[model samples]
Target chain A: MNSAYPHWKKGPGPMNSISIAFASGKGGTGKTSLAANFAKFLSHEKNVLLSDLDVEEPNVSIFFPENEKPGSSYNSKITIPEVDLNKCTYCGKCAQKCNFNAIAVYQDKISIFQELCKGCGRCSNICEAGAINLIESEVGKVNEYSSESLEITEGILNTGNIHTKSLITDVKKYRHRDINIYDCPPGTTCPMVESVLDADFTVLVTEPTPFGLHDLSLAVEVMEKLNKKFGVIINKSGDNDHIIEDYCKKGNYDILEKIPFDRTIAEKCGRGEFYYDDENYRIKMNNIYNHITGKIK
Target chain B: MKKIAFASGKGGAGKTSLSMSFHKYAKDNSLFADCDVDAADAFLLLEKEIQHKKPFYSGLKYKIDENKCIQCGKCADSCNFNAIKKTDKYYIEEFSCEGCSLCEDICKYNAIESRSNCCGELFISDTVFNTKMIYARLIPGEDNSGKLVHEVKKIAHEQVLSAEKEFLVIDCPPGIGCPLMAAISGINLLVIIIECSQSGFKDAVRLINLSKKMKIPYITVINKSGLNPDIDNNIEKYLADNEIFSAGKIPFDKEFVYLLNRKKLIIDSDILSGNLKNIFSQIKNRIEMEK
Candidate 1:
């Protein structure tokens, strides 16, 4: 009469190890600051890992001390189709079949532009003679570091490369421990999706403005589709705006926490200082950490 | 025709407000395109009524006929997205289906047939200001946002050409992702709305970097400039370093909330009209030079 799957019997625990992802549909909603402060708050009782998933523009490293070096680093490579000239027939079929226009056929040769390629393998699949083959192309790097109270992992996409999602996927591989915090890239796109897809819970950091309400709805839609638990945190709360609150009510979303707009917090962040040390900010972030942990557990 | 896009990497940076005000100030026959399909709200500010709606279908979804199915499991095995689940009865989860048609190609019994899935609806509307606006609404779980933005832009461009309009103001989706990229494609100029906050400045840099790479002429507008004077200074320095212009700074104004709540453009307010008029004139000059 016992169920075959014992793992399913036990619900999510206090999750002394939990990963709270701070993501926004658009950039500059204070995801990193919220992420860093949340990490600092959780570090008080558990080992925290702050992962900066904005591979294109990593800012988590700037907020930490100068002596910190990532504990380890990993490379992410994407397979881009590289045509073998000897095998190519110059028939122009690959170019004709490619939907992304990555392949081009000239008078006597076929050229592959890696930048335009989506790595979709359409051209390779369409090649009649199997002239096109995918080769490993290094797209980005993931760096891991350990701080006094937490571990940090950051992904850096090689500038001018379009394969950000692949790099983000590589970064997720480092989430070996529980209680991880992911700092998602701004925007509702493939890279953001890559960072957030695996999280058990997400914290949508937003300001109280029309634009904030607009993008928060998009992020909320993504969470709902993924069937992941989430709550809203109104950063810069005292702006005297009700757009977010109205949205929360309309959508039946929980408002987990609110952080008032403080210039000191901004100054500290600009100076590369952790603002979580500030008693007031720490208290609010701790409440958020506890709330998320409570729900996930 | 002049096409200008208002984009910001970070959300809540005032792209919509600025775009709406520009649409009002231009007063020259113009088409407003809300290219932020995920959350199209420029219409809300303009109090527009959707006059026409069209469903957007990105690709076709293959449906397997249970009557014709032989338990071969080839269709499930061939799906790269793991969209098909094999059980007593085979089925496809619409959300996971990318519409690659691999399942249809692999089905030996010819049981699978492809059908279009409705991602969202695109709208052509008439605003209270009497201007034509093009926008889209994406279903919560819809895919192909980039495709939707492209569709919206196409309609907006057609409207502009037919009306002999002088401008097309696009309120782009936040972030430099596929949707934002699609919104910026073929635009004459990009106005990046930046807020005076640490993350705001950081995102502005990211968006500007993307604009530079795309070879799109762009300028920065620091919204809510009075919030953090220090952060504003940092953004100015960053813009200077990048050789981008600080088009004009809009101070934090309570009237913005009032205007939005009333579903009216800021330029339409009698008290704020002068200020918005000046701001629009400056933006128009800058955009004209870029053209």
Candidate 2:
């Protein structure tokens, strides 16, 4: 079943029916804006589904604020252990059974730290006293924004929660459209791995700086391990660069597009305006979309 | 020792830049730790040779005994991660595998086993400024980065206590997640960096609320402040309404990347040196006030 990776269809599908995830090992390189704007640009000609997997601080929803009439939205909850107070004897059995240390019995009391709970049901299965029960806990909310032909579904994680991967998995459950773009979290960690591993294509975005170059290599290493087809997108490329360009050249990686650093673009971004509406960014993104589609085919 | 952490809920908001600038201008003898282990770029800024090194081990990984596998599908059926693949044989894909060990419990022939691998390596060295620095690199795809961050902080704290360093500067990871929490926990002072972008404002607000909830003494430092007056003003007003102090603002300058490219500190940059000194003074004063 494709429930775990709803956007990903195994093997090759039609040329334009592939899921592409945008990521950068270094954060704040404009992955969310680029993905959001590109999906908007692509939606003009096709059905586009943009999913935000950066649950810790989902920003895609900002581009599509809550509508007055409201699009469909729901909560994504996971199974966490609940203890029946009368049945609980402070036996430490369920606490010992949890592999994540989500439950610990101390001072004849049960303290459950929900952030650490993995919702694997191991504790309830191992509890012999019938004291532990598996109950649903809301880790994040999945909000959907729909227009004439586009749908943007974003997973906003509950603050101070640790189940980032689970929230990403929940967001990926959105109905598959012809083109799906998943905006992944920064850093080469579990969250990034989960977002890009199953996608048909991954677009690596980076700025022209040392920090971007260093982290881009780490992210590239992860894609190599996952055996995914990926390429690099250079953002804010200007003079005082060549760090990333040299690396990409030497590494034999494809350089998709370079969006130069401009004051107008940055200011527009600060005001929550989409760059794709501009003729310049529109032309560039159109080419980028064509390039990704060409490679997929 | 006074523990001060610089964190930006959104990455690339200049946490490393601000920390490096403060370290350059501060007077007190201090220790630094790069708690953003997953993508630790502060190490590159230090340009220091390792004085000591060791392998870090954390979390368990499931390994399949291919030789003993009976070609049955029990392990594949019970795996929670769907990491088991049956290409030629049932092999575990490490990238997707969470190592839950449910497959090991169901295997009839003991074909599955749990083994721990090296999470990454830790390095101990002195920065070009002569301050001791601790940084770590997480083995890609390894989970429990919060634990790695904790180990990095533990080493820095222990070393600072024995050496009597007056302060510890931590370059925290972006986002309000486990690793970020680990970096800020037990801190005497927390410096949150925020930019003027939409996500930056949103994430910074989340971080500020979490800091207040945890009862941590905190201040905000605006990075790339002058680029967009609208978002910047809104963020300043939001922080003010929340009763949080804005330490200072560092203007948006393309030359800020000079130090990152040259591997030098802000003091070396004519473009940034003047304003950086004033911002560093405010941060220093705040740390002393906390003391």
lDDT of 1 by residue, B203-275 (tens): 6788887888889988777787776577778888877886878777777666776576556677777877786
Candidate 2 structure quality by residue, lDDT tens digits, B6-113: 987888888888887676566356888899988998878774678888899877788778888998987777554567889888888887676556576678799988
Cα lDDT of model 1 by residue, A25-46, tens digit? 6555678888887886777787
Estimated TM-score for each candidate:
0.83, 0.93
Off by over 4 Å in 2: A1-16, A65-69, A85-93, A106-108, B66-80, B84-89
- Please list the residue runs of candidate 1 whose C-alpha ends up more than 4 Å from where it truly belongs after superposition: A1-17, A24-29, A55-62, A65-67, A71-75, A90-116, A157-162, A186-192, A207-218, A238-252, A261-275, B60-114, B226-231, B252-276
Cα lDDT of model 2 overall?
0.82
Winning model by TM-score: 2
Root-mean-square deviation of every model: 5.8, 3.0
